[model samples]
Target chain A: MKILVCISNVPDTTTKIVIGADDKNINTAGIQWIINPWDELALTRALELKDAGKISEVVVANVGTAITEATLRKSLATGADRAIRVNTEPADAWTVASNLSEVVKNEPFDIILCGIESSDHNGSSVGGLLAGMLDLNFISSVSGLDIENEKLTVQREIDGEKEILETQGPVLLVIQKGIAIVPRIPSMRGIMQARTKPLQIVEATSSESMTETVQVTLPPEKGKCKMIDAENAGEVIRLLREEAKVL
Target chain B: MNILIYTETREGSFKKQGFELISYAKALSGMTGGEVISLAIGEIFDEELKKAADYGASRIIALEADQLPDNRNLSKLLIQWIKQANAQVILFADNNTGKAIAPFVAAGLKAGIATGITGLPEKTDPFIVTRKIYSGKALAKIQVKSHYKILLLAANTFGIKNDPVVPVIERHNIEAEYFESPNKIISTEKQTGKILLGEAEIVVSAGRGMKSPDNWGSIEELAQILGAATACSRPVSDEGWRPHGEHVGQTGKVINPNIYFAFGISGAIQHVAGISGSKVIVAVNKDHEAPIFNVADYGIVGDVNQVLPKMIEAARKIKTE
Candidate 1:
């Protein structure tokens, strides 16, 4: 089996997002980038499938500029057999999906995996859009996955209920967290080997973006927290009912 | 112009977000001079359809089917409706079902799409919408460049309004193409009678500071007393102290409850992202400097074990009085 995992580089979870002076983009200076946490889990699961001999190869794909290659190499060092970088800064979910569809059309892969949504944009559109473009089966927010005899059994959460689904191969799954609890760390030897691994850079086919970021602004600062004495916990309830009016 | 609002239903009842979307669409129609049209798929009752009208739908379309089609098939159905209705704008609740199908529908229509939208369009001429980005840390004003626009509204962002206008209901029997899903839901498990965390007006959440799974009894009791849903931080869920369904964070469910109470949670960025939409936040933790206090409207530096019981008692006393 050949599995394609789509990854995105996003700001670290703890990074304080500062709107750039242009008012349409984030301030990139001093910002630490990492593989989107959800995508890292997806990549980890794909590698586990490969390790179990259920998949022959795992290829990591990203749609970004040259700077994204560094993150793709880290994915390689973590165990992806090869990496594909579509040379374009992803403008939106539709653009990313369009570019990925172009790549998937040229590659022979049985399964495509992606994080449910990119942490930065939080747009959970790419996987579903890609599946629609390819006319393939699509599952979103998958929490569990198992493959046997080319059939896939997936688990996903919906409205506080869990649904276990079964589907055949050639499917795209938008994985949520818990597919794998721990992400793999690249070893020294693995990092050395990743340098020898193939990193293919391809031009993005679609330059059109459906949505444009008109402005970026931080949320309004919350009011000062009213600190009540710990001994008077009941006062919190009274304040919630009388003052906040949210009880 | 026409605006299409996809109304979601469960067990023959309209979901709360359905009414919220209708209310939002009605307001949008005021700005665009568009008709508010709501589409409901699967078997639905007339009364449930009437709820959309009461909320503000000008017209309602009901598509009856025995079993609900999967997202792939549902998107195809929506595309057909969009073309037939000549819909310029489409709206959906940013729930599991909507998140799964809206993207496919947008791809099919080649429409500009925005998900997790928090407010109304900043501008309608070129169609600009505001959505939370960076996991609710910042807001982005986005311009839709396509002729057709799709939006998924975050839950509780738009308040529901009922004008009780009588709407024209159109019933159509259309045979939708169904895909053979390889996956079947073998079973579903949920805590009966408990409000779902996503839909709850008030939520009481815990974190690793609660120490052990056994201590959850008091937390659950507190939630029960307040008539609120229960949630936990990522570490609490990861450690098996709570079900993953109850996890609220960047990786977990994003909630917009009216009031959110966090106990023993040290407000990690990811966790804060999930609850940032709440209108009121209260945090109780032993650490005075826990990051949760930064976003909280109210804070109590105390042991959750002591604070929770007192709060629960107070809530119960207030209820009985």
Candidate 2:
């Protein structure tokens, strides 16, 4: 079986988030980028499948500008067999789905995996959108997965319940948090071999799919934390009802 | 022109988020001077559709067919209904199904959409909407700059407000077409827990400091006493100490509640993003300077093992008193 993992390059969680001067876009200046934390799960799980001898190769794919290649290379270090860059500045979910659909038109795999959502956008749309575009079976916000023979069973995290689903191969999944295993770091030899692996870059075609960054602005800083005095939990509840009206 | 809100369903009844979507749509309709039309697809519910009136949905468009189960086909049906209704704005709850179909519906309609929106659009001239970005560390104001707009609301962003003038629920027909391949649901496994996060008023979360899964019982006890839900840091979930659904972080569920208590959690931005919506945050970690305390309302620097049992005992005593 062959596996495909979609990867994203995003600002590290520790970075102080800043919008551009226009107030509608992320300020990329002076920020260190890393592989999106969730996508690491996708990559690591793929590697685990390979280690278990369930799959042959794991290819990491990205939809973004040239700068994202560095993150793709990092994915290779983590354990991907090769990398594919759908050379497009991923504007929105639809655009990324279109670019991925184009890349997938040529390369077929038994399973496709992606983080539940992009760290930056936190949309959680890609896996299902890509599945829709590819017309394949899909599950969102999955917490566990087990594959056997030609079928796959997954545990999904819904609003308040856990759902176990069974489906055939060639399925797509949006890997959610708390599920699966933590991503593994690449060994020294693995990193060295990654340099020799093939990296393909292709430009995206224009279509109805389009996304534009208008402006980005930070939310107002939270007000000072209000300390509810001891023996006044009722006071806290009253304040919530009267002042904040949050209750 | 009208506004279309997708009232998502499971089994048969309308989910709470569906009402949330209608509430938002009602607000948007009021702002846009448009009528609010809600669409309920699947084993259809007239009672659920009538409830939309309480939130100001003037019309309910429903498509009852097997295709409603397939999100791909659902998207197509939604697009058709949107075109038929001549909708200007579309609202959806940012749940799994909504997240899956909102972008596709927007794409099919040739419109621009904004997800993770916390509130109604501040300004419609340029379609500027506020969204929680960087895990609630900051907020970004986005402008769609499109004629037709789409918005997917984040959970717990708006509280349910019952309108005095309930909407008159009207039903309309939605034609559903079948797809070549349909995804089937074999079964569902519900997470065994005291309360669901979305419904919980308070949450007590544990981290690696709990030491092992065996130690989770104390946290569960505290949650039970408080009538709250139990959550964990990403590590605990990764280590199989807790179910993934209970993981709260950048990669986990984004939760907003009245109070949040952290036990042995060192605040990481990923974790912070998921729980930042809590009104009152209290952190109990040995590290005095753990980031969790940065935003916490009260900080107690101590070992979780020592602090947890005492806290649970104290809570129980308070309840008895």
Candidate 3:
């Protein structure tokens, strides 16, 4: 079986997000970018499946500016067999999903995996949008996934319990945090091999769509940090009611 | 004026959080002197619609359609809904589903969006809504200057209260377009835990100091006994000891429960951002200078391995009493 992992280039979680002076874009100055954390899970799981000889090739796909090539290369270093870069300025989730869907139409993979949400925007809309656009069976927040004989078993976290699901292959799986293995670093040999690996860059099939960002402002300031001096649990309750008004 | 609320359901049953969305919509409706109308798509739940009245909904709308299973199509359907009802504002349950579709609905309606909102809109010239930004590190007062407004509220942000009067169900037809791409309905699987983090009243999260993945068993046991959910710090997940889904950090899931207990966590800024909304935060760590103590309602500076067992025993005793 062949697997495709959709990745996103986003700011690191530790970055201090700031709106630019124009208030229409994120301030990219001094901020480090990484492959989105959730996407790491997808890449990691793909590597694990490859190690188990479950699949032949792991294709890493991303939609973003040319700078995103670095992100695709990083995924290649981690474990992806090949990389596909759809060169475009990443706009809204819809635009990205449309580009991915168009590229995916040319290639028919048995399973498609992606992160549930991106770190920079926190939109959490792309996977669902792509599934809707492609008209494929899709599941979000999948914590566990196992594939055998073209049949896939997935575990999703619901409100109060987990629900086990079964579906056929060629389905889209939007990975949540707990679903997959942690990423592994590339060895010296592997890193050298990645240099020779196929890293194809293609222009986005979709046309440029206009998405207007009105403004981005900082959140309001919080009140002075309130501390509760408590000797016991009962005192905690008192502070909650009297001081915090939270209980 | 009309106010619309998006309700969530699972396995033909309505989630309790859906009612909280109703309460929030009702509050907004009261401010506008409008009636609160709900839109419940997906699996059917007849009895759950009856509970919306007590929470402040004047009318309940049920779209008993299987085609509207996912949020993408659901948001498209709601577009015609807002036009039909002429809804001023739409309220959504701020879970995975709600968050997925809200931005789409906002974009479609050309409305401003505010997510992770904790409360209703404060009456100012341009309506101001309060939400947590920077992962609960700060509160953001957003002034949405749009003809139609869309708000997705955080889960557990509102406390559920029982109302004396039952709400009236006014069935309304939803304008829906079928998903032509033959998306099949497959099976869903459950996670390995006694209680879900969103629904749990209490939560006990551990950090890197637990040392090994094997040590999680004790945390799970205590959580099982207390009917609590188990959570972890980002490093624990980064170190491969726990799943990333169990992580609580700035980029991870934010949980707000009645009681949140932390063990072996150093309370880094990113980790603390996720739990700042918890009602009562309790910290247990060996470091007296840990930042978690700054926000914890109760702090116990000691070795968590030695303290957790005894605390669990004491908690069990209290419960039996």
Q: Each candidate's lDDT (Cα)?
A: 0.88, 0.75, 0.73
What does the lDDT read for residue A222 in candidate 3? 34
lDDT of 3 at A172: 81
Reference-based lDDT, residue B153, model 2? 86
For each candidate, what is chain B's TM-score? 0.95, 0.87, 0.91
DockQ for candidate 1, please give it.
0.73
Higher lDDT: candidate 1 or 3? 1
What RMSD, rounded to one decimal, does every model reach? 1.5, 3.8, 5.2
**Candidate 1 chain B worst ten-residue window by lDDT:** B176-185
The digit string of per-residue lDDT tens for model 2 on B1-321 reads 488888876666776677777777777767778788888877666776677778777776666754355556667778778888888888888766677777667656656777788788887766678777676767766667556677888766776766634555555544433543434567755545347675467888999988888888888998888788889898887777887778887777777877788888998878888888787777777787788877776667777777777667666765576
When 2 and 3 are scored with TM-score, the better candidate is 2
DockQ of 2: 0.38
DockQ of 3: 0.16
User: In model 1, which runs have C-alpha deviations exceeding 4 angstroms?
Assistant: B179-192
lDDT assessment of candidate 1: 0.88
Q: How far out, in Å, is residue A141 in model 2? A: 2.3
- If both were scored by DockQ, which would come out higher, candidate 2 or candidate 3? 2
